[model samples]
Target: MEYFSILCILSLSVVTFSETCPKLNVTEPLLFGDKNSNTSYDEDEIISFSCVEERRLVGEQYAVCINGEFYVSQVPDCQEKCVHAECAKRIDGYCNEGGECVCRPGYALFNGSCIDKKSVKTVISLATKWIPDYDHNSSNDFKVLQADICASFDDVFEIFNYTLRCYVSFKKSNQVTIANVINDFTAESIEGPSDVEKAINGAIQLGHTVPGMRYNVTEDTKANSTYLKECDENSDICDDHYGTCNDIGKGNYKCSCIHGTYQSENIKVDGTDCSVAPIKVGLTVGLGIVCGIAVACFIPAYLWFIISPAFGKAEYNTAAAAEVGSTEDEDEDDEEERDHKDDLKRDLEEDEELDKQLIFHQTMIQNMSNFNPMPRVNRDSQSYGVPNSIELSTANSMDNFNHQQSN
Candidate 1:
C-alpha cells in the first residue's frame, strides 16, 4: 500500500508537458507549425502553417522562434493580403503612395479592377463628306465626318447628348478636327461654311492633342429616291436647307469653276450695258476704219496727182527735157516714165488694202473696250462696297442713330 501510494504521488507529479508550452516562441531550436489547430514540432515532419494551409515547409517549416523582432520571412498575415473585399483597397497593386489600386503599365481597369489587360486600340478615318452652306453652319449637319465612337471617355458619353454630323461639300474642308467645344478651343461654329482646310490646318498648328476628338463611325448612306425632296426656289440649297442658288441671300448666289469647265455651271457673266447694242459698236468701229482709210488714200492720191503735176510741168517746161524730146529715144523714155507712174498708183491701192486687212486683225484685240473681260473680284465685294458718298440726310440719320436710341 505504502509503495503503491508513493508510485501514485510520483505519477501525479509527472503530468505531461503543458498545452501553453507550444504557444511560447523559441529559435535555434526545433520549429513548429500549427496546421490542424494543434501546435506541435517534430523532425522529418511535413507541416503547413495554419494561415497557409496548402503551403508546405520541408526542412524548417517555421522558426521555433520568430527570429528578430522584425518579420523577415513571410508574415503570418501574408495570407490575409488577398482577403481584402475591394481591389481598390489592395496594397499589392502598383498604386501611388496612397493606397489606391493602380493597374500596371499596358493595362486598364474594367470594373472595380486592377489587372493586366491589353491596351484598347482604335482606328480613326479622316475622309469626310458633308452638305455645304454659306449662310448656315455646316458643322451642325448630321453625318459629316467619321466620328470616333470610342474617343469619348465612358463617363463623358454617359453625361452628354452627343449628336455630330459631317457636312462636307465641294466648297470647304477642315483638314484636321478635334473636340472643339469640350475644351478651351475658342473657334466659333457659326452659320457659315467653316473653311475645312483652314480648320484642319489650325488644329494641326495648335499642337493640342491627347484627348483627341473622338469621331463617330462612318458608313455609306445612299440617297433615297422617293424620300428625296427637290430643291425649293425659296430655300437656296440642293435640298432647300441651304446651298446652290436658292440659298443665296435675296440677290446673292455662289459660283465655282469646276474641272473640265470654266465657271459655266450656274455662273452669271454680265456687262455694264445690256440695252446698249453690240451692233452699234461694230458699226462705229467699221465706219471709223473706212473713213480713216479713205482720208489716208485721198491725201496720197492728191499729192501724187496734183502736186506731182506741178513739179513735172516745172521740170519739163524748163527747156532741158523739151529740147531732147524731139528725138525717138526721148519719146520712148517719156513713155516709160508714164508707165512707171501708172504702176506706182496700182501698188498704192494694193498697199492700202493690205493696211486695211492688218487693221482688221487688230480690231479683235483693240477698239472693242465694251467686250473686254472684267477683272475678277470677289463677287460679294462688288455687291457690298459702300457708295463713296451718302446723301446728307442719310448721314445725319446714321449719326443720330449712333448718338441716340436706335429705335
Candidate 2:
C-alpha cells in the first residue's frame, strides 16, 4: 500500500513538471538564443534574445520563462543600426561615413543626381540615301565612291535634321585601267548652301577620297519642305494656337504640335484647329457627363420656372422696350471711349509701319553714302604724263571752283 501511494505521488509530480511552453514568436531581426529548438522551456529558466548583425535590439534583451511559458516583452524589436540617408535614393551611389553622397568614376553630379556620361545615349536617324551622278565610262568606280560618300554624310549629318546629296563625276584617265578616278566632287547640306565644294574637300580630307582631278563646283542645297516663314506670319494659314507651321515645301505647311502635346485625327496640314488627343478625349467625356446630369436634373426646373415665366412676361416687356428703342440721354462717354480705343489701335498699327519704313530708309541712306563709282587707282605708284591743253584747262577750272567753294 505504501509503494502504490509513492507511485501515485511521483506520477502527479511528473505531470506537473512536464508543462509545454507557448511557441516562441519574435519579430523580424530579433532571434531567441536557442532558436533551433523552441517547443518548450522549463519553468524559472532564463531565455536570452539578441539582434542580428547590423541591427540593434530595443527593449528587454532577455525573456523570462514562467509557468513553463516564455513571456516575451512586446516592446522588444530589432531595428536596423544604420540610419537611412537622402543620398540613398541614387542606387548606384552610396552615402559615405560623413553622410555625403558619392558616385563612381566617369559619373557627374547634376541637380542631386549622378549620371554616367559614358552610358548616356542619344537617338538620331542614320539612314542615308545616296544619289550619284557619274560618267558612263566609270560606273563601277562611281558605285564605290557613292558608297564611301554616303557613309561620310551619315557620320557627319546623323546629329542634324538635314539631307545630303553628293554630285560626283568620274573620268577614265587610262583606257587600260577599268577603274575610273574622280574627276569632280561636291557635297552640300542645309546649314551650308554655298560651300558644297569646300564640304567635299573636307569629306575627302576625312579619308573618303577618289583619285582624280577636282572640278570647280557651285554650291547647292537639297530640296526640303518642312516649315515656311511665310506660313508663320499668316494666322489663318497656320495658327500658333493649333500648332506651328512646318514648311513641307512650295508654300505648303503641316501643323507640328508643341512639346509634350499631340494632335488628334481632326488635325490637318492646312487646318487651323489642332486638338490635343488626350485633352480632347477628357473634355468630351467630362462634357458628356455634365450634360447628362443637367438633362436629368435641370430640364424640368427650366421648363417650370424659366419657360413658363418667360411666356407670361414676354408680351408686356417686349412692346415697351421696342417703343423705347434708344435714348439721346444715354451716356456719350462710352461711345467716345470705344471710338478712342479704335483710334488708338489704328495709331499703333500706323506707328509700327512708320518705324519699319524709317529703318528701311536709314539702311538705304547708309548704303548710298558708302557708294563709290571711281576706279581704285594707286596715286603713290606713278602718275601719267601731263594731259593735253584741254585737260589742263579743265583741271584748272575744277580747282578754281573747289577753292571758291572753300572760301
Candidate 3:
C-alpha cells in the first residue's frame, strides 16, 4: 500500500512538471531582454519588446511571466509615426491605422477663434445671420419638410427612397454653417443650396477659404450664378500668416510657404522659420574644415615630391640628371667587370689540360737522347743468365748507335 501510494504521487508529479504555459500574443517583435526559448516560463521572468521602424510603442513595453502565463501591466499599442504621413500639412495631425487623419499634439480643432486676427480685422466688414422664420400663414398652405423630416418618412413612403440630401449654408469670416432640407423644396434665396454646398465642400477639401466674403444665392440657379469674392483680393489671411496665396477662381485660394522652410512648434520666426538653415550652415562649415585639413596635410608632400622638381631651377635639374647618369655608369662598370671575370674563368678551364701536355712535350724535347725508338729488352730471358755486373746505360747505347751510324 505504501509503495502504491508513492507510485501514484510520482505519476502526478511527472504530469504537473510536463505542463507548459499558454502561448502569448505578442504584437511587437521580441528584439531585446529575455531570450530563453523554453516556452515553460517560471514566475517573474520578464520579456522585453520593440516595434517596427516608423512605429512607436505606446504603453508598457514589458511582460512578466506569472503562474505559467504572460502578465502585462498595460497592453502596448504600436502607433504609426505621425511624420510618415499626414504630418506634412504643418498643421499638427497624424494618420491612424485605419488611415484616418487626426490632430497631433499641441493642436486643437479650429473653433470660431480665428488664427489670423489681423486678417479678420482688416478683411471682415460685417457680420449678419439669416434666421429662418418657420411660421407664415401664406407659406403654411404648402408644408415644407426638413431633410430629417423627409428621412423619417423613408420607411412609410417609398417615393422618398433617394439617398441624397440638399443643404442650405452661409459663409461668414471663413466659417460655414449648414442645414439640410428635403428635395424639391424651395424658399427665399435658398433654392440652389445643394450646388453651393457641393462647391463649398470641394473648396474646403482643397484647403481654400473664401474669407470675409459674402455670397448671394439666387432661386433655382446653379452654384455658378452666385458671385463669389475674389481669392487674391481677400488674401489678407495668407499675408497675415506669412504665406503666399494663389488665387483659384470662384473665391478659392491655396496658401503655401517658400522652399526649405516649415512651420515648427515651440519657436517664433518669420517667413516659415527656415528650418534647414542651421543644418546647411553646419554641413558647409564641416566640409570646409575637412577640406582645409586635407589640403594642409597633402600640399607639402605633393610640392616636395612632384611640383617642386617639375618647376625647379636649371642647376638643380642638371644636378639630378648628373646623379642619375653616375648611377647608370656605375651599373655598367660593374656589369663589364663581371663579364671580364667570366671570360678569365673560361680561359683558365680550357687551357688546363693543354698546359700539362705542353710541359711534358717541352721536357721530352730538351732531353731528346734520353728516349729510344727501340723495343724494350726482355727482362725474363736476362733474369736467368745476366750477372749483376752488366748494367745497360742509355748514354752508352746512344754512343754505340752514333758510332755505328758514322761507320
Whichever of 1 and 2 has more lDDT, that candidate is 2
TM-score of candidate 3 to 2 decimals: 0.22
Off by over 4 Å in 2: 1-285, 296-298, 305-407
Q: Superpose all Cα atoms of candidate 3 onto the true structure and report the RMSD in Å to 1 decimal.
A: 53.0
Which prediction has the highest lDDT against the true structure?
2
Which pairs of residues have clashing backbones in candidate 3?
A: none
- For candidate 2, write residues 272-361 as lDDT tens digits: 334443434564566556556545544454345445445535644564456564554223434544665576566556555555655565
Candidate 3 ranges with C-alpha deviation above 4 Å: 1-231, 234-236, 239-242, 247-250, 266-282, 305-407
Model 1: lDDT to the true structure: 0.29
Q: Compute the lDDT of residue 111 as modeled in candidate 1.
A: 23
Q: lDDT scores for all predictions?
A: 0.29, 0.35, 0.32
Tens-digit lDDT string for candidate 1 (1-407): 99897656433311222222133242212233542444543221222323344332211112221111111111111112222234335522332212222332222232223332211111222223334432232232311111111122211222222111111112223542222111100012211122222333333333222123323212221111111011221211111111133222311233222221222211122211112123356766786787677667756765675566567557655644556646776676677668767866786776677667656646743555445333323223111011111000011111232232222
What TM-score goes with each of the models? 0.22, 0.18, 0.22
Clash totals for all models, in order?
A: 24, 8, 0
lDDT over C-alpha atoms for residue 193 of model 1: 20
